[model samples]
Target: MPELPEVEVVRAGLAPAVTGATVISAEVRDPRALKRHLPLGADGLPGDDGLGGHGVRLPFEAGVARAADFERRVTGLVLDAPRRRGKFMWIPVERGAGDESQPGSVPIPLVERGARDESKPDQLALLAHLGMSGQMLLRAHDAPDDRHVRIRLWIEHPAHGELRLDFADQRLFGSLALDRLLPAPDGIDLIPGQALHIARDPLDPAFDDAGFLLALRRRGVGVKKLLLDQTLVSGVGNIYADEALWRARIHPETPGTAIGPRKARELLSALRDVFTQALAEGGTSFDAQYVNVNGQAGYFAHSLNAYGRQGAPCPRCGRPIVRESFMNRGSHFCPKCQQLR
Candidate 1:
């Protein structure tokens, strides 16, 4: 799966090209990619609260109908700057060309539900999650369809002319949806309904460092597992978790309660350093699927020290690195350098 840095790269690439662009048409070749499009309510907003629980559920009807509905609503909406949280990315949508009530009206910003007045209209955003093998590629206006392209958006930008954004997913696990915008739990800013549950990443300026350290000292779960928890801290996946632990010289299986405040802070700093380095290298790409919008591979795989170096010598100590089975995945570490203490 593409992690935080990979998603951030895509968001950055999309910001300039798609900002202020109007969607001329939306083609859904495979309706499966529209799985995340939630049904709307009588008030023209999402059927339920932004939380994942207790919402209007998707039905068992033919997916083509759902795809049609998605296209109908998404067409003619203007895109604002692309935003991201954890591995999720979305574009703030504005009513533009296709709206019948106010054709050619200037685009209005999406207001948070908490602050929105009754007289104002509801707002929506285009949410995207790159499950396993998904790719959002930017191709020419008339370029041939890429393999497994589930959805295509033919958009017109005021400065860039016609452009095509293709959502290609080989495994059919990723999705595109038009979700309502709601105020974040902390009242920080508005976010897509589907992404409301994700916690702030370490790179976020609003991330609470002291709160994280306090929480880390109280959790009874293994330190690595706690780090991977999206609610506890967003964006640190298996690869970065292992590398951060190795840098902090903490065993993956060590309980969070066993780590002191100094050690916990060290782990957090290590995570930030790892993510920064990965972003600079364009993210850790090991295959063709995980690439930037332009289809270029990342070089961070070469700088890894612990994650994929099983049986190789540890860069810190002379001991060999080992791999252990963990939650259906593998955990690699320098056994000699990282102790249970």
Candidate 2:
């Protein structure tokens, strides 16, 4: 799965190509790609006849029908600048004045103003989750589709002409949904309601450093476990957790309450540093599936200190890195530098 850095890289790469562009056509080749938006009724399956009672229709139905609905709602809307929080990315859609009869008349402005009025419900958003093997690729209009391409969109831009945006997911766990934008507590006008529970990543401007440190000291769970909790702190996955802990000289098994204010502050600083370094390196890519929009692998994997280098020499203390079973996953750390209390 792509972490904060990798997702941010994708978001940054896509902003230029899709922002303000009108979606000419939207197609979902796989019904599973929209499973998240499809709500299951009491029967554990889609309602009878695909349309539920009282004119309420389930979003998840026959692939062709769902695709047609998606096309109807999003065909002529202008996709605003994409925004990201942790591993989730969404593009707000604006009902432009562009003529539906004419295919590419909408002009995408270079300057991006923030969301319009929060009270007015004139906008819809497209939420994308890049599951384990999901990739969002921007291809030429004439490019061939990859075997895993699940959703393809024809976007029209004033400067770039027509471009094909492809969402390819090999595992079928990734999804795309059309959701309503709700006003966030922090005054951000365009946060999806489903993502309101997710805490902000450290790189976000609204991230609360002091508040996180205080909460970290209060949580009685293991330090690494707390780090992995999305509610406590978003975007710190297993690999980054080990790296950040190793950098802070804190053991993965240490109790969160045992960490005092100073060590807590150090851990927080190390986390920010780790995320910043990984972002600079374009994130750690150990396999071909994890790549930027251009299909380039990240270089941060080579710079890792403790994540996958089990039995390798630790950079700080020269001790062989140890791997331990944790929550059905393996955790790598330097035994000498990060001793369990």
Candidate 3:
């Protein structure tokens, strides 16, 4: 699965290309997942250019020359830009990182209301969540369809003009949403600079030391399982959870509620370091699916401390990193380094 870092890369790559353009057309091979993403009644989409009408609006030569090519292509899924919520990628009304109200709290302007007129709307946010096996790629305007392309879009850009695109998902768990309503999860903040819901990034200044200790000490679940809870902290996926716990020198199964405040800081710091490093590597890829926007493997895999390095040597104590099952998922850690409390 593409994590926050990998998806951010894709979004960064796509932002300039998709923003300001109207959806020329959109085609969904998997309508079931598409419905989950962009519910019909919600209608958060841009002014529909009726997929067929776009062809006529194009230059005579451009339209006719591409008639055969555009025949079956879904008209327009104009991407006005996209946003992310923990793991859920969405399109909001404005462009840029958007106005940050406070940490984990950003106003998501959706739905045409008195607040935002439909005629002068800045852009309709194209929210997407690339689940475990999903990705969005920018291809040539007339690029041939690849084998994994489940969702396709023909976007008109400012500089590049018309560019055909694909949102490929092997697992079909990822989704797309044309939201008219920016539904926020209860209790989770969306401020751009402040903490995200599930993610208390190590880099943030508000990395609640006291709160961290309290959160962990309150939960009896294994540290690994507790890390996976988005409600507790946003964006700490399985890979990150495993890595952070390993770095903290605590077994993945050590109950979070049992860890002390001093150790809690270590755990939190390690989480920040792991995610910050992985984001720079463009996110990790142990499986065949997770490649960056440029289709390159991440650099973090070569330096993994314990997530997938099961039987491999622990980078720290030179002992073997052990792997086992916890919470129905694989748990890896350095046995010698992480003593049981």
Candidate 4:
């Protein structure tokens, strides 16, 4: 799956093309893409899979929803700015004029508001999860569809003209949904209600350094595990985790509680550096499966220092980088510089 940097690249590429564009039409070519949207007003029903108005069972799990309603709700809405948290990306939408408030009502900003004012209406959003092998591409309206294309949106933009937004996923794990945007608990502006539990990524302006340090000390899990925990910190996947560990000279298996405040700060700094560098390089794409909006592979793979470089000499010291089996994943680091506790 694409991590923060890769997802951010897609988000940045998509913002200009899709933002402020009105949805001319939306087509869901595959049922799997609509798995995350619940049927309208189906949340009040009891049971895990209660039958919806459409006679289909409501998908109760995260990222699972009734497909028919998902398609119907998003057809005519205008897509606002695209935003991302961790690997998740979403576009806020405005209802058609008929659904708007009466004249003289306070107009709401298209972007999520900073305050948690329940009296203000929540904005509707189109959420997307790019699970493994998923790609969002902007193509010409007349272009041919890719083999794995699951959803396509025809958008009309005043400046850019008409364009087609394609969501392609070779594997069926990725999905798109219509969701409500609720204020973040920390008073940060809107985030999908379904994604309320996800912690702020290091790149987010609202990331709390003091809060993260306190949580890290309390978790007592392995450093790599804590790094991978979406609740503690978002967007540091296996590759970046390894790179950050190597850069910080900390062993991946070291307990989070065991890391001192100075070391923890160092680790966070390393994480930011790695993320910024990877994003500049377009993210670490080893193959064609991970690409930007233009379908071009990232060059960050060439800049990898630790991950997938088992047995290669460490850039810091002359010692060889070694790979260790870790929680069903391989962690690469310099055994000499990043000694096990």
Where is the poorest 10-residue window by lDDT in model 1? Answer: 49-58
lDDT tens readout by residue for model 1, 24-81: 8899887778768764544544444232222333343546556766777778889999
Instruction: After superposing candidate 3 on the true structure, give the runs of residues whose Cα lies further than 4 Å from its correct spot.
Output: 41-78, 93-124, 181-213
lDDT of each: 0.83, 0.79, 0.62, 0.81
Choose 2 or 3, whichever is better by lDDT.
2
Q: Ten-residue segment with the worst summed lDDT in candidate 2?
A: 104-113
Q: Which stretch of 10 consecutive residues in model 3 shows the poorest summed lDDT?
A: 65-74
RMSD of candidate 3 to true structure, Å: 10.3
Q: How big is the positional error of residue 180 in model 2, measured in Å on the Cα after superposition?
A: 1.1
Off by over 4 Å in 1: 41-45, 48-62, 101-116
Better of 2 and 4 by TM-score: 4
Angstrom error at residue 297, model 2: 1.2
Global lDDT of model 3: 0.62
TM-scores of the models, in the given order? 0.90, 0.85, 0.74, 0.86
How well is each residue in 257-300 modelled by candidate 4, as lDDT tens digits? Answer: 89999999999999999999999999988877788888888889
Candidate 4 accuracy as TM-score: 0.86
> What RMSD value applies to candidate 1?
3.7
